[model samples]
Target chain A: MSTATPVTAGADTAAVRQAIATTARPPRPGPLSTALTFGWRGMLKVKHVPEQLLDVTVTPVMFLLMFTYLFGGAIAGSTSAYLDYTLPGLLVMSVLFTTVYSGVSLNTDLTKGVVDRFRSLPIWRPAPLLGSLLGDSVRYVIAGTVIIVVGVALGYRPDAGVTGALGALALVVVFSFGLSWVFSVLGLLLRSPNAVMNAGFMGIFPLTFLSNVFVDPATLPGPLEAFVNVNPISILATACRSLMDGTPDGEAITTSLVVAAALAAIFLPITTRLYRSR
Target chain B: MTTHAPLAIEVTGLEKSFGDTHAVAGVDLAVPEGSIYGVLGPNGAGKTTVIRMLATLIPPDAGTARVLGHDIRTEGDAVRSLVSLTGQLASVDEELTGRENLILLGRLLGLSRSASRTRADELLEAFGISEAAARLVKHYSGGMRRRLDIAASIVVTPRLMFLDEPTTGLDPRSRGQVWEIARALQAGGTTILLCTQYLEEADQLADGIAVIDRGKVIAEGTPGQLKASVGTGGLKVRLLDPGQRGDAAGILERAVGAVVLDADPAALSVSSADASRAADGVSALARAGLGIAEFSLGQPSLDEVFLALTGHLAEERDATLEEQSS
Candidate 1:
């Protein structure tokens, strides 16, 4: 074929030269911008691999349906009444459960070569960690909204209505954001994504279940009840329940916020340190 | 020997260790600006470790390196701003499309929304990955992923580029394409630090090569000087008549230093350090009235040089390293 040219011909060489000849580099991006860009990457991952959403979305929906139907009448004398009590708790459970994936995805990034690319860039060090948690907050919102919508469809009605539900979701999202830092630490410390996944679920499962999400702390033994009352998940769930009940518990809300803040304070630095050293 | 040639990378007494396995012992390198400097080594020869330390991905236990005149440790921000790394594995995000990967990097590099998209498209087109730009990178072939990886690195036209085994797992055609791209980058004045295990790759593209073994540079020179250091240029002759090979071997040993008969029975090769001696051996064969079907003289390949320097074949160490690492 006369049309064929040499591999390193004029066209290819010219193109490569033009691509890499720019002497002027754009000013380095600020930490917030780089973090947001990484968040965009996380969102794109969700868009491409929608299956990852099944854990956060479908699992919670299943829990909402199964818990309400299986023990609704036995626990609260009726399914509709049980939905009112369990809906807010389920929102907290769903969102917190979704936080585990933040670690899974972070570990996945570490295993892949892409983390090296990100590390070598001139961007902020914690941008990937913070930005991915930001993206995962979206997943938390999805999980919370799905459970609330599904509960409402199953005859749940909050005393404070839509505004109350939205407030509760915001609170739950903030808590999940803090909790995600713990998993980000796990993701960095662990060697494999599967190990991070297993460890994350193992830690989160007991914390969520041992709390008042599925049952009242009053129903447990004295020591178990004490553990449940002190559980941060239980306090968060209490704040969410009060918000949806139109009677905001000031003490419960303050404690949950403080606990979430403390998690961020302690784990964020640890996660960043592990990320840098690993 | 341009004494004043500005070095793109200057490493001194660089050291790193992973527990007991001293990945990089004391080593040094001076890479000239705009040159393709090859770090030729087998697997686990501390090649990746050295590049990682220089790229600021990991800290060295002891050492100081200046990349583009900025200290890799203290002035890391400056070095990062001017350089990029294409790691041993394709470093682009696998979940994102080819276009998205470039756009993401462009955005991270401070381009505006529209500008990042424009630059991404330009790179996708330049790298000949425009057709698969919309497809997820996980679906791309090895060559396409490598091109996209390189495109992502140059989103802002880095002053220095670190290519860690860029053609490691690629097919021959893809490897050639990568070499072409690398040469084109060099033409545009990008100083490339290429790491590879394949001797031919270094021989083909490296203007200067550092032969690294056991976490240290055993030798550093142009490919010619390295081959010459081994001191054996082979002269192989294939005869028309198999019976004359015995007489030819005697003539070659007399003129050259040593001769080894080939398995083909009609062929024999002589090892000579001097080009004049090789030519004299050829003439001596002709004078003896021995039939000479064909004969050629060439320097010892880098494979031979690596073996003579390391006491083991490059591939032999590679197999052991691969097994241990995996």
Candidate 2:
């Protein structure tokens, strides 16, 4: 082969100069852009795997129908009253269940080496973790809306106006977001996806079930009642009920918001630290 | 190779430990700009650990490394911006298509939508993966996935690239294809830092080779220089008849002024300082009424050089593990 002509050499030099100039400038895809990129990719994954949405979509509808007809009359003394009582816990439960998937999703990414690939990139530090958290909120919102809409269809009335109902929904979404951060950290620390799922469920199930979600805490036994009164999930469920029923000034509502904020503050840093260490 | 030009990558006193075992201990190296520097070592010799530290993925326990004039500890983000690392395993997302994987990496590297798409198309074509562009990576062949993994690292046209055993588990043809890509990148002035256990790979590609044993570099030079540094070259003479082998070996040992290793009676091998002395030895042996046999002389191979410096063959490194465990 003949030696390179000046034309080819000139073109090569021009390309190199362009590449150098581009690299010398500040890196593109700033932190916010990188975060959104991760979030968008996660949402795309969810879009492709519609079967993964079965829990969020189908479970809430089934739970609403079963609880209203099967346990409503016996537990709440009447079916109508039971519908009003069970709706708040059902909404919160939907958010809780959705957050468990966040941990499993993160664990799957870690096991499959996807997270390691992200670590090799020149992107923002918290993008992958935060993006997954944000993307999973869509699942919570979808499930929450399905449960509430089914409740409305089955003759459960929300005394709160449209604004209060929306506010109540907003609280569930924010709480779910906060819970995802906690689970995301757990996913990073744990070895297997199943371990993350089981551990998350173990930590969350008691707080969710032992609370005054199914009935009034005042009516419970002594020690159990005291525990229920102090439980954060009880506060959140009570606050959600109050907001939907047009009674938003309860102590439970204030406590729930504070607890949600506190959990978020604690878990966000933990998740970021775990992500950086990995 | 470039007459001691400014180093593209420099590391001094690099050290890392995992719990009780020291992974990397007191290592130093300098890779010249636009040169292919190969760190040759067996598994668990801290090759991956060093690459991870240089890629800014893991913090070193103690040591300072500079890449493209930026410190790895304090200026990690800067080093990350200028360098790209492809790990030992394929790192592409299996769920995404080949085009999508490349585009995602390009976008993350700050390319605009059109630019990312264009770059992705170009890379797919360059790697001969254009036909598989729209197909999901989960369905790609092993070689295709490896190509895409390497292509993802070059999305930003990094000035420095770290390849940690890029051809591991690849077929011979695929390994040759990757070698071509590495050479092309170096020709474009992109500095490459490669780590591999394949002695032939280091011999063929490395401008400067560093042989790392345990946790430290025991030898560093150009391939030929390192081979020469092993001191003695040898000639192997194979006898046509197994019966005459013993007589031939005895005659050769008496004729040559060097050491003779006779493991197989059918083969006579002797180590001498130079080929001229070996020729004299062969003439003396032929005059001694011994049957003439086939003979060939050459410099020591990289494997021989490794054995001379480390006192253990590459294959023998694993055998020692069983002894230690027992």
Clash pairs (backbone) in predicted model 1: none
Please give the clash total of every predicted structure, in order.
Answer: 0, 0
lDDT of 2 by residue, A1-278 (tens): 65664422101223333433343323578887777777777776677676777865676567777877898898888889999998877888777777888988888887766666788677788888877766787777777887788888898888886666677788888877777778888888888899998898899877877987777787788999999888888778878888998988568776777777887899989888877767
- For residue B64, model 1's alpha carbon misses the true position, in angstroms, by 1.9
Distance from true position, residue B125, model 1, in Å? 0.7
Q: Considering chain A alone, what is the TM-score of candidate 2?
A: 0.86
What's the distance in Å from true for residue A62, model 1? 1.2
Best by lDDT: 1
Chain A TM per candidate, in order of listing:
0.94, 0.86
Question: Candidate 1 lDDT, tens digit per residue, B259-323?
Answer: 76666899887644467888899899999999899988866554556657776655533434321
| lDDT value, residue B168 of candidate 2 | 91
> Against the true structure, whose DockQ is highest?
1
Candidate 1 C-alpha error for residue A189, in Å: 0.9
DockQ of each: 0.41, 0.19
